[model samples]
Target: MIDVRDLTKVFATPHGDWLKAVDRVSFTVAPGEVFGLLGPNGAGKTTTLRMLLGLIRPTSGSATVAGFAAERDPAEVKRRVGLVSANTGVYPWLTARETLAYFADLYAVPPALARQRIAEFADAFGLGDFLDRRCGVLSTGQKQRLNLARALIHAPTALLLDEPTLGLDILGRRIVEEFLELVQARQLAVVLCTHHLEEAERLCHRFGLLNRGRIVRQGALEQLRAETGLHSLHAMFLDLVGARRQLPVTSLKSAAPPAPLT
Candidate 1:
């Protein structure tokens, strides 16, 4: 349900030189797939997502979500995609329930249906205890849970999660993992951007390893191991970085896509 090709983003530095934040990246995520967009800080993972959300225009290339080009059919693309990020914001004065209802209205969901959806998500995420509390007073984990609920209010078909589990406790993380599994069961696509290798390993069917504005490696864990001769994800990551140093800065297509995760 998500397709990106040659997606590049360039920014002007103060010195008037170009900085390629994302360079010629390409990938596809089918319905029911969770593709991990992995990298350290400043790897352009977030930049790629912003472009997909139509928050920023790409310098070149194309991104399509659910068959709608992100740049041309942005409204349609947004209607079919839910976004959750660590940087997500909630209205400080609004109660958790109210916040969700407001977003549901923005998506044009009926009032009655919005209430039902909020109730379901509240139960699923264990937010009933704090549903009436003002967002400004909530703890970090509570706020993150509320953020997840907000993203799902309209029941979009695709999810773009950037560190969605960042502030959660173990229970909170478990809830999110369970939620992702449920969404995948219904054939929804998810793009997970995270620094937690174990989290990515547990949830992702495939991965795109990004570094210095490029997708240096991509594919399933097994495929990565075969290509790099590394038995572990951590080792594979180290090798990917190491290989980049040995070779000239160019795209490497060593890893092949694996079959969809069951």
Candidate 2:
């Protein structure tokens, strides 16, 4: 389980300005449930996840992951969490098998067990064809699969995914969805951060809609539909953020002119 309470992050700019990237966000994620942090770009979703993972210290409030305080016991939190991102951070020079082996070693898995786990995941994710191929040689879809495999090498209790399908085609997207289904079947807690409303609706049990550094609304899909009177998540998002205006840019010219020419 994960518990976040009034979490906040403030950045100090070079010009003596403070920017509030995350503003008093709070939410709880139970074991074995898929919870989504849905928002557009710059909506504080990444900041909130970073805080929960202890990548950056929060300016205020607290987060606990698997009953360990995120700030004080970041190592313990990391031990229980698996992270996957559009940028999987695998070394391009390393082969897929080597990459997985490297992370398994970092997690201190015994060499024998690591080898067994790598083989299991490679077969499950269909990486046998390219397990020995350098990461740089793999296609985008193949790389995404490798990324998911790497995250699962440790059999973590919680999974944190950030735009996992950012640069994939339809087939690749389906591959990711299928992998997610498998993860859910294992009853792993998942925190998914994605801009795709349909994907979230399909995978998440509940969702929190964030905007302008705050959680504007949150609930199950059915509850959101009932509360907003909207049938689709896309429509709910548009209504929450206000529909995009189609006004022309040239209409904003000012009438005032310079009084004197130097």
Which candidate number maximizes TM-score? Answer: 2
RMSD of each: 11.6, 5.2
**For residues 1-262, could you state the per-residue lDDT of candidate 2 as single tens digits?**
8898999999999999999999999988887788989877888988988888888899999998889988899999899899989977679999999999999999988899999999888877889999999998899999999999988888888889999999999988988898888888887888999878898889899988888889888889999888888888888777767874465665345756659977
Top candidate (lDDT) = 1
Encode model 1's per-residue lDDT on 160-252: one tens digit a residue.
999988867888788789878878987989999987788889899999989888998899999987887877777666665664355455445
Misplaced by over 4 Å in model 2 are: 244-262
Clashing pairs in 2: none
Task: Assess the local accuracy of residue 189 in candidate 1 as a C-alpha lDDT between 0 and 100.
Answer: 91
The global Cα lDDT (0 to 1) of model 1 is 0.89
Superposition error at 172 for model 1 (Å): 2.0
Candidate 1, RMSD to the unseen true structure: 11.6
